[model samples]
Target: MASRRKTAIRLPRKYAKDEVIEVKTRIIHPNHNGRMAYKDQGYIAEYYVWKIEIFYGDESIITVSASAALSQNPYFTFMLRATHSAPLRVVWVDTQGDQYTESVDVVV
Candidate 1:
């Protein structure tokens, strides 16, 4: 199994109903592009977060496809309409098939 990495998520704990809310997220990753050669080893394999998905309850709020072009520990921000209090789930999937998930409770 892959080791778990650090992740951060920021959002208002409470919001008005039907109001647009801002969400900020980030994950710690090496984001190797498989272009650099190691001292003893050959070129490092490409490994990065290929997809990121956010869900408000059961509905998908946002989905993104990332590549080596993104910087290390990529950051993302987006807006969503808060319709009710629920759990906001964030998932990041890497090229190695590892998945990281974090959840925050939102109140309205």
Candidate 2:
């Protein structure tokens, strides 16, 4: 069930030390469970991004447990203080054990 999904993160190219910044992330997915019916289909099988983990540099910043209640192509926005130059990574896992990851460098 592993496949590549379009994932993106938007942030500033450079930030000042201790400056609070906004991080926007998105993943292209259907996000449907077995309950939702589709055209000509009885019900869509269970498939969704079940978990999301965000990391700044070496520190774990956030972890989100998601469900099918989330809309398709889920978008997320959050704020964090830019403390140093490091990679900000987001990891997403789907119900079928599919994983998608995207990262951006936070330069301060």
Candidate 3:
């Protein structure tokens, strides 16, 4: 089983219909690129969040593709239009086929 990591998100609890709001997210990850080598250990295997998707209810809001170039514990901020009161889901998929999901309720 993949190790569980921490995630943080910030958004308004409520908003007017069609209101544009800022959504911020951060994930705690090592994001190894399989290129680094230590004096004792061999090359680290590549393990990074390769894709991220956000959804409002069943509708997809955004999708992002990331690479190893991204910094450790990547942070992202984006704008989303509030259309209804529903659960917002965020999903991240890593290179190792590990997935992490989280959700928060938003009132529109």
Candidate 4:
């Protein structure tokens, strides 16, 4: 599959050291589950995001395993402690083995 998906990352502009901060992320995808009929084209194939990996700097913070049951254009929000300046990254992998990544700098 073609990798042309859009991603977004939102974070606070200012945060104190060791302060808990909110991180928001999103990805644009169809997330087809092979159940939708397209006129006379039969059912759409089962294609959706299966895994998501979150990283704070070089450390893996969270990993999520998903299925076709997930909705299209998934959005996720989580909290993290602002320890130091580092890059917060999120990676999404679909059933087609396509990867989409987005990152933002978190300054403590």
For this target, which candidate reaches the highest TM-score against the unseen true structure?
4
lDDT of 4 at 99: 95
Lowest-lDDT window of 10 residues in candidate 4?
A: 1-10
Model 2 lowest lDDT segment of ten: 1-10
**What lDDT score belongs to each candidate, Candidate 1 first?**
0.87, 0.90, 0.85, 0.90
True-vs-predicted CA distance for residue 38, candidate 1, Å: 1.7
Positional deviation of 36 in candidate 1, in angstroms?
Answer: 2.0
For residue 16, model 2's alpha carbon misses the true position, in angstroms, by 1.1
Instruction: Please identify which of the two predictions, 2 or 4, would achieve the higher TM-score against the true structure.
Output: 4
Predicted candidate 4 versus true structure: per-residue lDDT over 4-62, tens digit per residue? 64988899887899999899989998899889998898998989988989999999999
Instruction: Compose the digit string of candidate 1's lDDT tens values, residues 14-94.
Output: 679899989999999888988879888898889998899999999887889977777888889999888888999999999
Q: Relative to the unseen true structure, what is the C-alpha lDDT of residue 105 in candidate 2, on a scale of 0 to 100?
A: 90
Name the better of 1 and 4 by TM-score. Answer: 4
- Cα lDDT for residue 56, candidate 2: 95
True-structure lDDT of candidate 2:
0.90
Model 1, residue 106: C-alpha shift (Å): 1.3
* RMSD (CA, Å), each prediction: 3.0, 3.2, 3.1, 2.9
The order by descending lDDT is 4, 2, 1, 3
